[model samples]
Target: MLLDLINIRKVRRAIVYFGLILAALFFQNTILAKVPILGVTAMVIPCFVVAAAFFEGGVWGCVFGLVLGIFYDLSLAGTSLLFTILLPIIGFASGSLVMFFLNRRPLSFFLVSAAALIITAFCQMFALLVFSQTKVLPLLITGALQVLWTLPLSFTAYYSCRKISGLDLSK
Candidate 1:
């Protein structure tokens, strides 16, 4: 039955998404965290979510994003739920925007990834500035640095998600 097939597909997708999230978490904490550059680890997380949105549907992107967000938030010293809330919204928006006005192209993927990074970094910097005595200039500079690091990684993430999702959003 169609319903049975749908359910099975959902289960398979869940498994794949879970695996990706777990790997991301493990690598983020153990390896990527040690990278000489700060914020690189943080930026990579949302790239995966954005890639999911590009290759799969909004539903898939949102679910993976939510899970990644929760893990990302919990890892931080602060209990900020910004990642938990924002990535899913970004995923959903990415999928919806692509569906409405873009083809599945490198440019499209870049734009979506850039938008995700911008929004996430902006919210994070703004939150830091507002809630603490952090200087705006430093926050902005850090965000820019993170974005620079994330750009190439976004392409990798996009291709990786396309492979993992197996959804071909071009349809």
Candidate 2:
């Protein structure tokens, strides 16, 4: 009986985690786009990926990252195959790396966020350069800007997740 209850609790947590991911994605796509400053610029999917990596470890984080990345690609208007494929790989690597170095310190949030941004930027740059045959310099600049915006947002999301889920990630 106790084991079943525990399993149920875990299942509930997993559901809540996935629910939050979906909600964040939706908000990022719709309502967030309306805001003048922060809207449309935020990298909510990457932030959620970091959160999943932090809380759920490597495998699950990678899976969630793939799902979030695919959703992101789908939300866009034009046809972009690379985005759908590359993002998942990036997410998987970032999540796995973060979990490998899993620490109990608060600084992990910043570190993980930074790593996520860097990985995302690199993936984007690669896609633009190789697949799209675009100018690397402009893509690099934009990727940097995106990283700057994503850093703090990732931290905030991680903090909120910890608060809501009551997961003591701090050491």
Candidate 3:
């Protein structure tokens, strides 16, 4: 009886996460991309991963990060499998922070989300600089703009995941 209940909760959690992923993908690709801030579009996927990890733990974070990373890789043209590689690490680290030290709160979410975004932006900047011979200043500017633009939405992702995590699956 207990096992059955646990399994049911797992299923419900997965379904909720799937729905969030779909919504995030739609928002990121369609609406968010269309409205550029400083000519840079927001990459909101990392924030989602960070928030999920913040609430859900490292394993769940890593799993969803991989899933979201695939979507991210496919959505952007001419990019290597960067997010696929980076997001899982980001998720795992974020989750580990929660497991080891941090509490689950919006402030924690904000800090983790910002760190994740900055790391991703740095990785992206490094890739552009090394591979394409892009100028450092432009790459830095774009990456900074993207991080700044996306940071505000971390609250949304945080609250969404927080609400989902707080659900009473047994009921």
Count of backbone clashes for each model?
0, 1, 0
lDDT of prediction 1: 0.80
Cα-based RMSD of candidate 1: 2.8
Q: Using lDDT as the measure, which candidate wins?
A: 3
Q: What order do you get sorting by TM-score, best first?
A: 3, 1, 2
Number of residue pairs clashing in candidate 2, backbone atoms closer than 3 angstroms, sequence gap of 3 or more or interchain:
1
- The per-model lDDT (C-alpha) reads 0.80, 0.68, 0.88
Enumerate residue pairs that collide in model 1: none
Candidate 2's residue-wise lDDT over 4-31, tens digit each? 5578877887788778777877777776
The candidate with the higher TM-score, 1 or 2, is 1
Better-scoring candidate (TM-score), 1 or 3 = 3
TM-score of 1: 0.87
Q: State the lDDT of candidate 3 residue by residue for 1-171, as single tens digits.
A: 777657887888999998998888998998998998768898888999998898789999999899999888988898689989999999999999999999786777888898999999999888669988998998888988998999987788888998899943345
Task: Report per-prediction Cα RMSD to one decimal.
Answer: 2.8, 3.6, 3.5
